[model samples]
Target: MNPVATWRRLLAEFAGTALLVTAVVGSGVMATTLSPDDVGLQLLENSVATAFALGALILTFGPVSGAHFNPVVSAADWFLGRRAGTGLTAGDLGGYALAQTLGAIAGSILANLMFDLAAVDFSGRDRSAGHLWLGEVVATAGLILLIFALARSGRSAVAPAAVGAYIGAAYWFTSSTSFANPAVTIGRAFTDTFAGIAPASVPGFVVAQLVGLAAGAALTLALYPGVGQAADEVVVAHDGGTAPTHAGRP
Candidate 1:
């Protein structure tokens, strides 16, 4: 890709990630504020807002940056490009990852500001444990399998809805509330609110997500053999630039 186009894509990733974390943290604060005593109610509110916000964001940004607000998704896209030779370059991967992480942090800060809180307080909620890690693995693995499988099966068009629905469901089913994206996990650490995770816990979640990424890659091969995106389809790049053919699922 040309330098200009690379920067364009990175900008999209950054903006998309910022908006996503804004939704996550903002809605979390809203939910907790509205339902201070009812954990279930808070989860319900957060999940609904997240699902709707995610679906809208994907549709809005997919064309620009593959909507890959998640670092693992970028990694997966890069790995596929390396193997199949039709996706992101290494530079693109690194840039996208960095943009997404920074965007997420910005989003978190924005959320805090909106809610009249300290903008950069670290979370105290310790989410480290075998169960939480297992949940992360399960949540991330399912996300990978769902996204790539959709791309392989020529269903990337439905990813906006499908991916959102999956994450919403995963929120309730998974123990860790489906912090499937490493960038989001890191971003969540910046806020000590209902949606926040302690900085200490971010590394563990990131590691589990990576392990899940590997597992999902293996599963994609075993389950959907020889699934490649069609030429007419693109994951991101609103300018009609080509990105790896995958579900621009974040």
Candidate 2:
């Protein structure tokens, strides 16, 4: 791809992730404000907002960057597509990850500023527990499985709504409230709000997520042996109906 096109994709990842995190952190703040005495209500409000925003962001940016707001997704795309030579190159993967991470951080700051809180208040909410790690693994694994399954089955059309609905449900089913995305997890750490995960908890969550990514990939391959053929279209095909042909750009 040309430099301009590459930059557009990178910027799409950045902006999409930023807006997603903004919705998450901002809604959490608003939820607490609106439902001061009810944790369940606050979570419901937060999750609903996040789910809607996530789906919208994906629909808006999917054509530009495949709407990969998570490092694991990008990595999985590269891994699955490596053999078939249909997905992102190593350089693009790196760029996407960096942009997403930075965007998450910036999003946290934006949410804090909007809520009149400290810009960089590291979360104190300790979420480091064996069960929480299990939840992360489950959440991330399910997410990967769902995305790849949709791609492999040629059902990418409903990805936006399906992904959003899955995440919203995961929030209630998973013990960790489903911080399925590494970038989102890191972003939540920057805020001391209802959605914030303590900085110390991040490493464990990320590790579990990576493990989940592996498990999910194995499952996808087992279920759809030719899933790799759809790697360039994972989440969604964003190359103007053409898959990226940079198979040699390792």
Candidate 3:
């Protein structure tokens, strides 16, 4: 890719991640206000909104930056494609991760401000349990496995809807509500709403997610030994030469 294309891809990653966080945090606030009496209803509403938004974002941005709003996805792409030379390089990985993380923080603040909340109110919702950690591991691992599997099997075209659907289902099935993305976990800590995670709990979630990343990579390799050949097409192929980013799920 040209220098201009690099910048463009970076911009797409930033904007896509920012909007994804906005949807997650914003919808949580809306769900609470709309259904204050029922936690289950709030979760359902939030999950539905997030699923739709995530799929849309992937479709919109996948052509530019692979829509990889999650650091783990980028890392996975690099690791898997290192031998094949088809995924993100080390420098590109760093840039993508930084952009995604900054975008996520901005998104959290945007969502809070839109809902009349403080700009940077750290969440107090404690989610520091062993079971929750286990859930995170499961959620993140499953997510990685799904995306890579789609790539390896030449089915990445359906990743947008498939990834969204998997996340929505994971929300109900996982104990930690499937906060599989480290960027998202950090962003959610900035708001004390229905979807926020406490700042103190962010570390554990991130660690679990990393663990999940490893597990997912192992599973994918075992299932599809030739997955490395499709590393550049993890989520979906893009116009640019680089591998497209994965969906920035919360």
Candidate-wise lDDT, in order = 0.82, 0.88, 0.88
RMSD to native for every prediction?
Answer: 3.6, 4.1, 4.2
Off by over 4 Å in 1: 1-4, 228-250
Candidate 3 lowest-lDDT run of ten: 241-250
Question: 79, model 1: CA deviation in Å?
Answer: 1.0
Task: Put down candidate 3 lDDT per residue, 1-250, tens digits, no spaces.
Answer: 2233788878988899999999999999999999999999999999999999999999988877888889999899988888877788898889989999899999999999999999999999999999999999999999999998887776678889999999999999999999899999999999999999999999999999999999999998888777777877867676433442333211
lDDT of 1 by residue, 197-249 (tens): 99999999999999999998778768765543321232433344343344333
Among residues 3 or more apart in sequence or in different chains, the pairs in candidate 1 whose N, CA or C atoms overlap within 3 Å are 63-237, 63-238, 64-237, 66-236
TM-score of each: 0.91, 0.94, 0.94
RMSD of 3: 4.2
Number of clashing residue pairs in every model?
4, 0, 6
> In terms of TM-score, how similar is model 1 to the real structure?
0.91
- By descending TM-score, how would the candidates be arranged? 2, 3, 1
Where does model 2 exceed 4 Å of error?
A: 1-4, 239-250
